[model samples]
Target: MSEASIKRAALYRMVTPEHICPFGLKSRDLLRREGYAVEDHRLRSRAETDAFMAEQQVKTTPQTFIAGERVGGYDDLRRHFGKPVPDPKATSYQPVVAVFGMALAMALAGSWASLGDVLTLRTAEWFVAFSMCILALLKLQDLESFSNMFLGYDLLAQRWVRYAYLYPFGEGLAGVLMAAGALTWISAPVAACIGTIGAISVINAVYVERRALKCACVGGGSKVPLGFVSLTENVMMVAMAGWMAFRTWA
Candidate 1:
């Protein structure tokens, strides 16, 4: 296509000897994907970048201009094209949903492989066990961070801080034992102990106190809110423990 037929955008970004702005590359890629020819302008030093920002009255770099109209920074450029911009502080269940979805898939696959069936009582048990394992794995990734987050809402963790750290290992162990349908004597008590504490904590924090907080059930890094989903995790654990005990003894 000719120059006149092409959509054109001018992007100004910081590209110093020490650093290159990542968002600038993102902006350039977006423009090209949207069929725009980008005029890439590098503010080679901090002085030049500051001057540009001052002139544009903008706070950040990776600014884009289209049709002689300044579209601000990378996020602003996305908005200019009517694209949805991601919010950092947005409450999202995507991570939790993904973990649960994967756990369910694993359960179904395991059932088919072992029993030649996708749906069964064992599959449901395995699904919950797998979910616990995954969730515990997420927590164990950064135990310190998870503990810190858990201490915010957990009653037992607040009183005895070490419980927060040990919680992941206990949950993971319970999950493994439950999945194998072995040593329910050990797994049942572990699951029940943690699950009761977790459920009560969630209810107190989210239901009774009505305080909105991040859930440590998935991980400290997760933005999953402290609410029904969080409660469900604990409830599932408690229910799993009871079911295992009943199956083994009654």
Candidate 2:
């Protein structure tokens, strides 16, 4: 074939209707990336395509032609070439676990009878109870999003936007509870109960997620692996609950 003929005879696949995206740019970028361009019109008539394939001793459907050689469809070629596999999701598990840890530590502190006058059970109580409550409230937003997912809707279409607002809310309440609990021993039990409930919620969420169910903890920058965070939170709740029970009975 003449160089001019070869230059104009570019390889292209007729785009099936399914090949389009929601934005209607079906595989254009992908085709461009694969050393081919999308033509607005089919390059060859069906009979001509079949004739070419018969002459080349190749199958006709979605074939590739390069330098007088039938290269086959790029998909099949890629399979032969072995494409790199990408990670399914960018797993994350930081802030959620940290919150649970902080709450549990505070709960543990409340159970320490020998903490002395500077910091008494009352102080621990307020911090634990209030912090846990704040966590529950913050998590409720995630729960709302998760529930919506079952109906084919995505919660928090963008990442970390929700957290920008919620982090302050959590910190504010946590600060108040920490201050109040530190001043009075009476607030300690309440804090422990709050913490216990929060932790249990985390655990339950994780369980549901593990069962291929919806997730309700998709909060700010929370794209990480949440199953572990959920488990840890649940254990922390149990620990806090046990500590509160022990203190109450003692």
Instruction: Give candidate 1's whole-model lDDT.
Output: 0.94
**Which 10 successive residues of model 2 have the least lDDT summed?**
149-158
Residue-level lDDT tens digits of model 1 in 59-130: 899899999998888888788789999899998889889989999999999999999999999899999999
Off by over 4 Å in 2: 1-89, 97-131, 141-143, 146-221
Q: Mind giving the per-residue lDDT tens digits that candidate 2 earns over 1-250?
A: 5545433213444434334221113223444565454443343455655666676576644554445454465454444346543344656455556665676566566556445443656655544454555555655556545334312212222343454344334434543544443422333444344345434444554554334333334343345454554444334444544555566556
Which residue pairs in candidate 1 collide? none
Instruction: Output the lDDT of residue 205, model 2.
Output: 46
| CA lDDT scores, all candidates in order | 0.94, 0.45
Cα error, residue 191 of model 1, in Å, equals 0.5
